[model samples]
Target chain A: MSKHVAYTDFIDCEEDVRIRAKDQARVVALREKKGWLFRLLLGLVLIGPGVLVMIADNDAGGVITYAQTGAAYGIGFFIPALLLSGLIAYVVQEMTVRLGAVTHRGHAEMIWGRYGAFWGWFSLVDLVLANILTLITEFIGVTLGLGVFGVPHVVSAAAAIAVDVVVLLVLRYYAWERVSLWIALGNLVFIPLALMSHPHWSTVVSAFSTWRVQGGFTPAFLFIVLANFGTTIAPWMLFFQQSAVVDKGLTVRDIRHGRVDTAIGTVAMVAVAIALVILTGTLVHGMRGASNLDIQQILSVLGQRLGPVGEDLFALGLVEAGMIAAIALTASTSWAMGEAFRWPKSINMPARRAWRFYLPGLLSAVIAAAVVLIPHAPLGFLNLTVQVVASIFMPAAILFLLLLLNDAAIMGEYTNRKWQNAAAFSIVGLLVALSGVYGLTVAMPHLL
Target chain B: MKKDTLSLVARTDRMAPVELTKAQVKGWVRVVFWGLRVYIVVMIVLVAIGFARGQI
Candidate 1:
């Protein structure tokens, strides 16, 4: 009995301390490696969804929102306001990294397992619907972008669809992430377009100090603010990043790197958004009643103001933004569906084994493409509806995320700190209020 | 069999229940859950009314 007791004590000691200590040691050693350049390169290689989600957040619809903001309101108030949205995006997305790392479960799977089927199905339906609607907008951006160069809508849609299929199907998860990252890098084209506009740099900087909206807080101004908020953070971003982190096999050790990845993406997202705002604000805002112009009219104004080269570059940025977003949104839909239905979910899965996972996304793209090809398909209403649905659904999605983060059973020692919970809930309140105001505006335009 | 039993015993010991109570954490969740639900329902009703009145 004495001998047995001694042996059990040794085993307990090993379990209580040795394993984690070894892991901690390994992590420390890995971090202690010398050479800053090597570390940067390693981070670039390691980062995935953090960056992708941010860039993808600035999608086709988002570009138009920012452009319209510039044309309508100019760089007066939105410059700092949009910059602040980057921080909001970071705070929301950071939780996704931690959740993915600690739990090794996608958001849908976690919600379904913990929150019961009602919320699970609710989340799934919202995600799939929003994704499809968002994809149609992406196809719109692609067609319009290419149309400026005389590419027919049919040809543009087909080409975009083909490229998306090949990227999603032919490559495994890591390979797909890398390929998408390269495409995401192309989103920087807007930076140069902003620079090329040659705006009054002092006025742009001084807007930060002045910090005033051009007009007072009228209904029109509030509408644009709501649009900006809707575009910055959406339900798809939450699903996409968490699933990407899990699929990438990120563990707690990788959380720091995941954060850096997301930080880089946030910077890129806001930079491009602000650049578009600048480009449009500088060049297009001068036209009489330019705020009322549609996207086509905005593009036309760009052509007239910036000349052929600048216009072409802006168009290229729009096309790149749409294509990259399509990739992310498609993966997000596939991951969610896979989690919901118990299908194989990883981008790492071979086409043969994961066709069910890929099919939902592919079919969604095809349907969106077909819809975009329809002549005069109520694109305006579709855009407004997408915004409304996203706003209405935002609070619910955020509620689930916060609940999961706080759950002791799921998060173990990694549950949110008290302040994190406070900040997160505050954001939820703001979102709910925004959704309510948006709802009122949509339902009773006269009241607004 | 003896080794396996010992490891299982060790595992359970290492994964002892956390410091926070499930009920305590769940209190916040229930509040946010109901709150968001009420908000969504209100929004839907307003939009429905708008559509009915040709406002949307």
Candidate 2:
């Protein structure tokens, strides 16, 4: 009887083992299938933030910057300059994607944890102030763009503020991003505008091959080059992309797809920037005593050169750039505030549930709108403040980025490869040197 | 006997474990790191100048 019992127990154990093996195999198969599905879903999901961040980087300010660069320097140096700026933008933004995915933290939180409160607050203050100032410029762009069509600045500002509120508050995250992207795509209007200019193809092609600096590195040229660079990889871009990635909930596995999105955005951004330069460089530069060109001046010239249609297109592009960037900047402000204060931060959260997260953005928009309405509101001074604060905060932000990227505890096997570190470090060094040169040029314009 | 055995086990469990110290980052590496830091600072300054110039 004991032998019989032992035999029955052995059979039961063998049957259990068989069942377990089958379950394990089934689990493995499902996991494999799920991973593939997750990759596909992630590819679709991760597409928006990277592209939106890059497009927002090429804001109304950037459009004006490129237009001015072309008018001041022509196509000689800036053609290649756009390519270099695009590369720098990609490198810096790619790091943010990776950092966000690996650590699942926003730039503010990372700074707080790694460097502590002082630097964290310093970074936040810079970001908030810069964002506000930048928001003002975006509104300025919207108003000026609409003003081209005989709309009043106040009307345009109000309408723009209205549109921003509707898009941000009424829409979900996915819808908000898509709408912003559609508006951003309006920037491509410059490409057609550029084609209308009938540029010398050979000269344009040779500009790249020759890599010419045209006037041989004068202070003015250096200033323009640095301005172009600064516009491409501004400080807001870092905070915005990091927070966007966090909000999107990207994981390390999504890094490849995120990179693809970033690459597409970089290409699109550079293409638009180059086209803007081409339009102004061909039409406005050296055209019988043309000087002191701003975006308004450029539009006026385009109207004269290519008639009313050209002017209208330029205005539309400017309006789009402004509105899209305003949306992004406002959202970034809210995200940063939420991250810092440990409040619930997501477009997914309903207004009632996430009022704290939503309020900062709404208030920022209101404040910027009010500032724009005031007469002689130190527009130039505010612009300078934005650039200065962005400059001051960039190093601190990059330091935290590098620190987090290098931390094995957080990054595990995905820490930056040595070559990436080398490239990132080189970019950082070059930017610092340029800034020093710029300071000297400012202090003593005649010396350089 | 059980108490004695448990105490011995607890003492063994509490033995000090080995730890790895973080290596100091130095040489060209150190230079590169600081250089990147300075580069970022300069980039900011250039941006400020560009803004001041109001060209862009």
Candidate 3:
């Protein structure tokens, strides 16, 4: 056993391979059947990781960031800017889908193997820290969401942790993915909230043609842009989606369907983000220090402006965002740790068998849940700092991803094409520029 | 069962480790890696400063 330990991998683990193969075998069955109905059903079955990662992309912090953006700048510039970030989200995430489908490995394992131990350890530590902090924001969203209904933070925290544990330990991969997808639909509650707010339809439409910032270029504006970018794509997303794709048993053949899954998810994420911005922008825009206000303050003003029904809807959406994101984030943490340490890491494994894999993820969630319960914890400050950290870390994460995608020895025929490389590199450049602006703004307060 | 589809998941060694040699990490790749390392460190320091001053 000790001699074989170094070769331990996710698929190599008995439980993981058995469950994944069982699930993928069914997808294969679905593909063999004729008719559009089977195709439709197959589409639903195949749309797991990509969609979950995308919807969960618009996590609790993301919801607040979009809401804050709307409340600050209203709907002119960010409307289109949000959509472009969605495109960026697609470009970055799609690479993971291909990488997973071709390589059948988690992002952590790929980095660990291909780049050597130092880079591997660096990426894993960065991701785990990022995931934990992001999970804290998710819990804050959960508490704030339920607190609107008179639920205490302690109760909300307990309930959130319990639900996450149940969802992870109780379900198999297929069941888990289906259940997660259904839960993710709750994120769309923002669409109804946006519609009910009665945002100026003409302004929303005109935003595309005009594409002009309400306040012109400023450091504050740039920081907000980076924040939105941070919300749209984060380090956890890359790890979560790729591991998910591999666990779901996607092969080179399923890459087309995987892209379909990802495309649908991108559309949903962008649309919901737009709804968030529109809902808050229409009602809360022009308030004093709109950008500076946290979610709780924004919610207070939203209640006053839109009445209890609107407030209640937004609250529910916040809870859903937090819940779905916590689920994805927890699993990603476990999978990354498993890949790094060679533990049996699959949602399909019984908790008893894969306790090592399950332990780290559960502990991270518990820590985050505890953090949110601290009185005077500066949740808003923490939220901003986490976003800044993630934004700063984006280029490094994408650089590793770009490197993995280009390695022809492993990817073989699946290697990234020139266009793909060019697009991905440009995204890295854009993130670096965004990060630089952030640094410049901080270093020289007078400079934009 | 379609063996090809099931084959994707049935195996384990498909993702065996592939460590790079010292000679492999070179040229623009080396420069880019060094540049990114410096970039990440600087950005983190700047963010720490911003957060400390409450300007970010």
Chain B in candidate 3 has what TM-score? 0.57
Residue A77 lDDT in candidate 3? 94
lDDT of model 2, residue B20: 23
Give the DockQ-based CAPRI class for model 3. acceptable
Which regions of candidate 1 deviate over 4 angstroms?
A: A1-38, B1-26
DockQ: which is higher, 2 or 3?
3
lDDT of 3 by residue, A1-448 (tens): 2223232344454556555667776776788789999999998889899899999998998998899899999999998998899999999999999999887788988888777798888888888888999999999999999999999999999999999999999998889899999999999999998998899999999999998987788778887888898889898999999999888878888889999999999999999999999988898888778878878898988789889988998999999999999999999999999988878778878898899999999999999999999999877677766777687767888998998888887778888899999999999998898878878787667875
Tens digits of per-residue lDDT for model 2 on A62-171?
88889988887789888988998899889989999988777656787676665556656877888888899989888888888999999998999989889988887888
> Highest lDDT among the candidates is held by which one?
3
True contacts kept of each: 0.24, 0.06, 0.31
Over the stretch B1-56, how does candidate 1's per-residue lDDT look in tens digits?
Answer: 44544443333223121222223324756776677678878988987876687654
DockQ values of all predictions: 0.20, 0.06, 0.32
After superposing candidate 2, which stretches have Cα over 4 Å from the reference? A1-42, B1-56
Q: Show the colliding residue pairs in model 1.
A: none
Per-candidate Cα RMSD to the true structure, in Å, reads 6.5, 11.5, 4.3
Two-way TM-score contest, 1 vs 2, winner = 1
lDDT values, one for every candidate: 0.82, 0.75, 0.86
